[model samples]
Target chain A: MTEMPATEMPATRFPKEIAPWDVIELTIPVRTDLVVLARLTAATLASRVGFDVEEIEDLRLAVEELCLSLVRNGDDGRLRLRYTREGDDGIAIACTFEAAPGRGLRELPVDDLSIRILDALVDEHGRSSEGGHKRAWLRKRRSRTVA
Target chain B: MEQAFDISEREGTAAPVVSVSGEIDVATAPSLRNRLQARVAGGDTTVVVDLAHVSFLDSTALGVLVGALKRCREAGGDLRLVITEPRILKVFEITGLTEVFSIHPTVDEALEAPPR
Candidate 1:
């Protein structure tokens, strides 16, 4: 695997209100092999928060898509993922990266099939950029009853 | 880096069958694409992808499959899939690709199906 640089961001970058039980944060090198680590982390969190089998699968795929999108657009950066359990039955995931010089997040292909897949699997999603860093947020609400 | 996935091909009863077993994601997608492209380039019109052993499927991998299918059809051949894992199948369903590709429960079923 190609050696990619990774930096650990200070926890202060996140909201101060993050409860230990509700938040799981990971910083992984922006390598394809490690994308599975992010996906499995998201799945485990979602499952713990009461997401059904199907919903957990959806979250897994959505997280993987998010990572792939960032890796494709950003030439070099560590992937920072934050998963938070919403009140009772919802999960929200945030992914962000400080892209390499000349490789900003604006070039990400938002209209591609991968984005469409993310949209279909998640309840809501949004993107934003500031200071050369880009972030994608996805939220999924667990069904009250599993079929 | 060595690819995390592998693709092996064999002659089926009626078409060429490729069995892929591993997680298909960004890192491994290019390898899958190259193998499928080579098979299509070799003039095997009909191809069946056996994905029962695939533990994970991402959009990049799905895009590779879609691209391969398009190439095969343009060459007057087709691509079919044998998928049984519901987790992997859910990815196809969410993308609405279940309707786009001919999916069967087994490789034998895919090879025995009437030609498209």
Candidate 2:
């Protein structure tokens, strides 16, 4: 994978090696009413990936926060989400938002309480920007005992 | 779009009980906040919020709860919560709010507790 700008560090990078089994992608209008669709999708995918009840709930909340951030900061463009499962127990989610013209990919406010909540739920998270779009990504590894 | 959120309030023996079910996110948190604020504004010092039926809760909802707690305390009242779902409980634990709010297993217990 190509290196993204240091300021936009985490969103563009992928795992060094990944053998994904299933991939799910969605693009929805940037509206508050549509945020639940993303949350439900994350929960369903996390559960299908054999995540325990707690992990599934965590993923659901994390995805909601990501979508909320995009809707709060994004232009009137649609938001895109991609969920990928690697091997058997690893799940990764990437959310990309289209920036309004003249407004480059601005960083999602890190100091916000929502970001803090997302940090506590996911194992790892990062954000990056390229062209006029920005992406935020989160990764979680299913518990060995459960999966 | 139809909202997946609902809030119902009933008069309890000690205080007003607000039962919230369904998803609480950015779009619906304001409703919850307004309900809680009204309870505080009504001179009810002790309020119990039942979240056992809430299927989903996000950080925005959490922030609203925290804000309500502060408002209640400032007005010489306090807000208590009744939560039993592990998923909802985990959000409190992750945010260290488990210690901030007076959490009870049931609305009855929350109402029985002494006001702060």
Candidate 3:
């Protein structure tokens, strides 16, 4: 696959204190078969955040890309996801794995295609080992229309 | 709470056609690889993959298609794809696969297009 240069995207931070009502959490086994649960949750949250239909679909697809990348390389574990609402601006979804054993942070999908997809779909996409937690995340902003 | 991922193929056409429905992710992409590989190994390199009914597909699915495309070209045949879903199409467009494979909006169109 041909590698495309990474496109620089505007980064947004997840809220410091997301209200309980502004967040949704789900923990599921790191199985490819169950990643659909994450996609479903993404759609629901995007809709609640006032994302357009097409944007909601993009969010779902973006979430699928992130979740599948984690589950495929991960061993027996649980994927914990935190969906934080940035008020009326956008939504940020972060995923981290609690590995069963021999757990190490796997890099964000290295496939050129997966990287391109993530770059195109979300405003911020990345992987990190912050505070000893292997985390992957993507943040999408609702498209704003001006009259 | 059922996750649907199904594939149906018919070899009666000049080029066999595989119609797939539901999401195609890592878990189910192998099924797609197996079907396409079987057809190619059986000497049917010119196959039509219809993804009209499929609403979602990811990189794993893309990898399977790329592999099949390589096998088909090496055998003097090609894999024509019918994908009308904009969301799925965007995946191809994003990854530059739009230029790599022969994509059509309909099966009939894909079947009639000249092989790449």
Candidate 4:
């Protein structure tokens, strides 16, 4: 078979390169003692994206609140956290249970205190399920600086 | 006193333990708040909060501390803190309260430190 001309040939394009620290994944036990790990990681990523001090704190608390909610309702499971950068303005932290094979995500218990605290702490907060994994997410935007 | 946590004051001193030394999260923050509120309302401003024994605190705890700090400042005094645990101090650092509150390694230093 004769090859097509270069103009008629299809070119392969690689996927876009992900920025450094654009995406981070952490897996830890679903234990109360380990919630601090999530909080510190969230705060560090938020700071890297230029979030102000107060915003960093807000994200830190939001992550802590969410993680505690998961740990309280869970038992001896593993938690998977995905930190994805949202443009250059902020960060989004998504949490899910790393359940065993053939297992469904447990019902996460969100107390009144957690609800009220999260409402006051994060820019966006909610839960979602994709494929099979269930995820709870909270997003925080970098505070705009005064001129 | 053996419930979620305990709140006590040093004898013969106007300073109340705004610290509420325990895991001061949503479950225990109210106790700390009530103690701080009572002290400030009782005319005990510029209190010494010894959180050195505390290992964990959340935003609710932070809010309670902030509220107490505001009330103290309005009364022409301030809220000083004694925090030795790095984990506990990290909460204040991340929240930017490290700059707002006068933090010391010891209660005596916190008590003796000048107010902002």
Candidate 5:
């Protein structure tokens, strides 16, 4: 893969309340650039943790699904993302948007065919309500093997 | 933000190859389906689709693939796919297409794979 120049990537900042561990959060306005950024980030994370090609692919799919979900339901102007390390080979990613009728992930169940595939790809995934904000979180644990 | 679709046809020793690139979204899928249909109608049955550059594929895009598969089978031709990118391949897997279509790791491999 060609190395993307640092200048090609835009500078971004997260809300003051977001933690420093959140890669996606630090890269706010990740909506339009999700496809490429998510794939690149997954590839980097996978390589860092020594994941196989198929495992890396699975991580890309999970990130794509998350981005798709956020784009479909997120607030128009900006969205906040958060990530935290869970354990060896595991990372938790979350995106918070305004709490509105369609914005609630409680109604955005993962029963669909796409979501089912995403569920199989990740170690753990769910959504939580924190009063004013709803967060969809997915835990990805790097796999040495493709399975 | 990008070209909706692009097609390039090359004549191999035995089969004709059709390379498709870019997003296969709701708005762009029809053009892709039409391109394949036109090739199948032109009596080119053994057509291979190179999807290495495709960034996204939705349900409508899968429908086009299935339709092309059916059309090729009816016309006594074969439809094969060359997919190296994980993002596009994930769409095929999510749609249970790995079992339906012959997927090749590289375009050269797909071109060399024996016709069905």
Candidate 6:
């Protein structure tokens, strides 16, 4: 068995937060390798948004959950990420994808365990219909003081 | 893209309870994370994440739990993990998380502990 080169691993552009903070979006192919890349990218972005060690971990988890949801929905298209900064509170991130009916994210019962955990990881979350696509939005609050 | 495990958690008066009854591989770890996050969001700090029913656990799953503990602490709370199976406990022990977080022999013990 041969090993993959470090550079061959999934790599994406790191968006810069110029105006206090701006939502950075990226499109990556729906592949497991890219999923790991997405997770790492989210971690880097969270750090840039002034997340502490703990907050970084939370962001990573959020990204993983979002990507996992996409994978489950057979969202093998492009993975979309929206990164934004919420005033004094923290950064808001959204990872979305397109899925067919009864395919994307079914509304887990309000008391559902997974839904509850996803909500806790982020400060704000919801689902919406846009352009005949179902999207899941997740927000991560920055714990550090904005400079 | 892969099939993952199904995770569920319930909070009692004393401790929060978690039930993971499937494969906790990369595909299913997110569900576990999602469920764990929900519990923390509801202001339930002292948590008992039961791993007894789980047959599998990977690094991603471990990361999810560790992150959950960090979140609980930030919110002035803590997490207790229950691992009755030897395989799961071995992972905790190998990862050194066994020393980092409180691990109980049963879910009852985890839930019974006073909130931190």
Best by TM-score: 3
Order by DockQ, highest first:
3, 1, 2, 5, 4, 6
Off by over 4 Å in 4: A1-20, A100-105, A130-132, B1-56, B59-116
- The digit string of per-residue lDDT tens for model 5 on A1-102 reads 111111111122222342455344434443443445655575666656567777776776676565545444234434455655444465656656554455
What lDDT does each candidate get?
A: 0.79, 0.78, 0.82, 0.71, 0.63, 0.63
What's the TM for model 5?
Answer: 0.57
lDDT of 2 by residue, A1-147 (tens): 122222333442444455444788888877777888888889888888799888888898888877766556335777899888755676778888875456555554543656667778887776766566777778887875651
lDDT (10s digit) by residue, model 2, range B75-106: 88789999998888888887788989999999
lDDT of 6 by residue, A1-147 (tens): 111111121112225444743557777766654665666677777776678876776666566665554344344466677776554456655666644335544332121223434555676655554555445566766655756
Angstrom error at residue A127, model 1: 1.0
Worst 10 residues of 1 chain B by lDDT: B1-10
DockQ of 6: 0.05
CA deviation > 4 Å runs, candidate 3: A1-17, A102-109, A145-147, B1-3
lDDT of 1 by residue, A1-147 (tens): 111223232223234465787988899977777888898899889888788778887888898877766667236778899888776677788898766566555445553667678778887776666457777777888887644
TM-score of chain B of each: 0.93, 0.92, 0.95, 0.89, 0.89, 0.86
> TM-score of predicted model 3?
0.89
lDDT (Cα, 0-100) at A18 in candidate 5: 29
The parts of candidate 5 lying over 4 Å away from their true place are A1-34, A46-54, A70-79, A96-113, A127-135, A144-147, B1-7, B11-15, B20-46, B51-78, B83-95, B104-116
What's the C-alpha lDDT at position B4 in model 3? 78
Question: In model 2, which runs have C-alpha deviations exceeding 4 angstroms?
Answer: A1-21, A73-75, A100-108, A145-147, B1-4
Clashing pairs in 6: A23-A83, A90-A142, A116-B38, A117-B34, A117-B37, A117-B38, B4-B28
TM-scores across all candidates?
Answer: 0.84, 0.84, 0.89, 0.54, 0.57, 0.47
Q: Which scores greater on lDDT, model 2 or model 4?
A: 2
Which residue pairs clash within candidate 2?
A: none
Specify the highest-lDDT model's number. Answer: 3
Better of 1 and 3 by DockQ: 3
lDDT at residue B89 of model 2 (Cα atoms)? 88
